[model samples]
Target: MKKIFLLPLISSLLLFNCTPKETLDETFQKINSEVLANSKAYATLGEATSTIGHRLTGSENGAKAEEYTYDLLKSYGLDVKYFPFEVETWMRGDVEVQIGNLNKRNYEVYSAVSLAHSPVSADVDLEIVDMGNGLEADYAAKPGAVEGKIALVYIGILPGSPEGTSNLHRSEKTALATDNGAKGIIIINQVDGGVLLTGTASVTGGLIDIPAVCIGKEDGLALKEILKKSKKRAKITMTNTSDQIKARNVIATIKGSELSDEKIIVGGHLDSWDLATGAIDNGIGSFAVLDMARTFKALNLKPKRTIEFIMFMGEEQGLLGSRAYVDAALKDGSIDNIKYVMNQDMSGNPRGFNAGGQKGADGFFDKVGEHIKAIDSVAFTNQNSNSAGLHSDHQSFMIQGVPYTSPNSNLDRSIYGCYHSDCDDFDLVNEEHIRNNVRFSSMMLYALADTDTLPARKLNDAETKAFLEGNGLKLKLKIGGDWRWED
Candidate 1:
């Protein structure tokens, strides 16, 4: 009888110990179900927008936003920390722009706003030289045309430009104008119906000697027509403020249970252009990241590699916040431990992921995409891309040879017209779309964190230079003074 009892107890113990561990597929499914059922991304963003409004770095609203995210992450029971940094930031002030013919007393006042980093005080009246497209080739076409005068350039490439012409950023155009000896610049907004846009005009993030401002598309075109009839002079008078300020970047860490030494960073800029609420500009991206952290904690996930969810500030004025973080990482020698970085700036409705020119990452993401597709075949089509671009937080890491990727966004075309404009409000966001960002991106983040080994490794100096050149970003980097390689 004793032997039979002992045999039955041994069989029960063996059965209890044989329970299977959860697979990645099962975890992904759970993530999808949990997000679909209970996601606070949309609601949290709504609260922040309705209450805090635009989160411009170094502003009161910006500080509030920082604290808000910090508290939320703390509520999620994650290891949260604030990395503070000092930066000289620029703010908009009073401005006035007028246009009239040369040698005329009266001028036609046009609706315009001063671009960020404009002169602290400026009063200039000069002839408006229309340099088409504002490319170096355009400057070559018209020698000494924009010298000591006001330059008028289109915000986008003209319709009849060369077939392979690449457009420059507004800041780059301003830089070209300054380098060509222009006294001031008048950028024509591309949007129709008198919509003016404002962003940073100085590439160096320092106060520019000449004033720069933007005018409505209709007004600009009408001014162009008048100039065709006769020469016109533009008067840009503005007063901006530049001061030193302190800003903080919020980082929430989910420590890995197994491979704690390896790290994956998922970050988005919490700061936005102060034209409007910045709801679509980054509300979708940053808030989605916040909720992803919440989801990971709620599910009690412990990936093999640690993940750091960061909300970066000072992105609109420049990449100040992310640059600070990367600098700190480099100083501490923990930069090598960072294996991957995923940035989501203005990202929504993820159709696929971009490999960011990282070698061997395409196959890795493709395999992971299948699991995402299993969750929602229609929304997540698993079509990945291998493109890379600049003017985002990822550039800070990409330059350091850390591999990066982002969701291939499919935002509405209409909404894009409001970029850096006043129309980027909470109304532009769709609930299901932002939810999709959280679901799909969180899955990708987990896959990178929990995988046995990452396919992409940190590139050395030569390999990084080759990657940038191949992606055609070398010229842009040189233009922005970010090129580290010798020409």
Candidate 2:
């Protein structure tokens, strides 16, 4: 009698244990279907790029962008918050450069937009002096040649350039010229037959105290001719301002039941240059992630781990919002709970998703790449071994030893032509491409979150140190001796 009762009880327990709660594959399918079905990608992207317009870092538009993104996420039923941070603000006021002495014909020239954290400037003129490729030898040959004259350096290095070439030729040329008493700088375009492209300055704050401008090849040539003919020299005058500006990061969380503490982050930046709307630069990424979150909630597919969608401000300003987030999370130990981060930036171009990350995460990226290929002929390249970090907001987490990946396209000769210019508008984005990227990234996140075992954190101390040393990073070593920390 005792044996029969115990056997039956054991059988009942086995039956209860055998019933499955939910499989990873099932959750992925549900989530993927919802993402595809409720794809409002285009409309959302249009509103983000056109309606709210350019969200320059630390500007009123930047703050408004934070509000817009937070409200959108909150409306989608996710727990939302604004992560406010301080950034040195800079703004572009009226800027003008004119050329008239060449053949005595006046030609209008474009002026550089003030990059975040750049100093204010007043109308001033500096003698224009051409520094060939701005190389050290060129500077040495003409020591004091740039003295008291604004150095007109070419945009990129020459083909037969020297080794250990400092990537700061353009910046250094300005600094050196300024230190030697030059009033400003004019960077010439390196394009063979293309117009010059002006961009905002780097967001690193300082008081080097000089105005810099980028001019087109045509304008540069015109100025060159003027310098050659005029008894005096070519001149430029600019006015700008720098002040304390406010910005914020938009955060939204979709809670899970089984593992609420662990998180998977997705999304992109909301800021852009004031030239044209930043449709292709990052509007697509923001919209796709927003749609993904909305779809998941509408389908009521509760993930095993929480999904956090962040729309960062000041990415164009050197990833200020994301960096602030990482610093805070690392200081407070909140980064410990993060499983991984999948950053979607500039995903709407004709090209497919290209994956890159730390070395140990190669296998994970390979699997994702294979999956993307199976869905569509989306090309994927593994950049794990090279350790090319800090190109985007993803770097913020990777610096803190977080396993993260960014789905970006390769920057071949063809791709750079349209990036970060007035041409990066809605027409530049391919709908099919954006859809495919969204599908791939969403599936990857769902698969990772629902998996029984997390992908092992494989970046040991040796690998981490080698990476940091090679990349010129000064990192604080952890006591565990398995990872590095950022001081």
After TM-score superposition, what is the CA distance of residue 189 in candidate 1 from its true location, in Å?
Answer: 0.9
Worst 10 residues of 2 by lDDT: 474-483
Report lDDT per candidate: 0.91, 0.64
Highest TM-score scorer: 1
TM-score: model 2 vs. ground truth: 0.81
Over the stretch 169-277, how does candidate 2's per-residue lDDT look in tens digits?
Answer: 3545555556556666677766544443545444233434666777666666666666666623444655566666678888878886689888888868878766666
The root-mean-square deviation over C-alpha atoms between each candidate and the true structure, in angstroms, is 2.8, 5.5
| Candidate 1 Cα errors over 4 Å, as ranges | 1-18, 162-164
Model 2 spans with C-alpha error above 4 angstroms: 1-28, 100-117, 158-173, 176-181, 190-203, 225-232, 349-357, 377-386, 410-415, 456-465, 471-487
What shift in Å separates residue 184 of candidate 2 from its native position after superposition?
A: 1.4
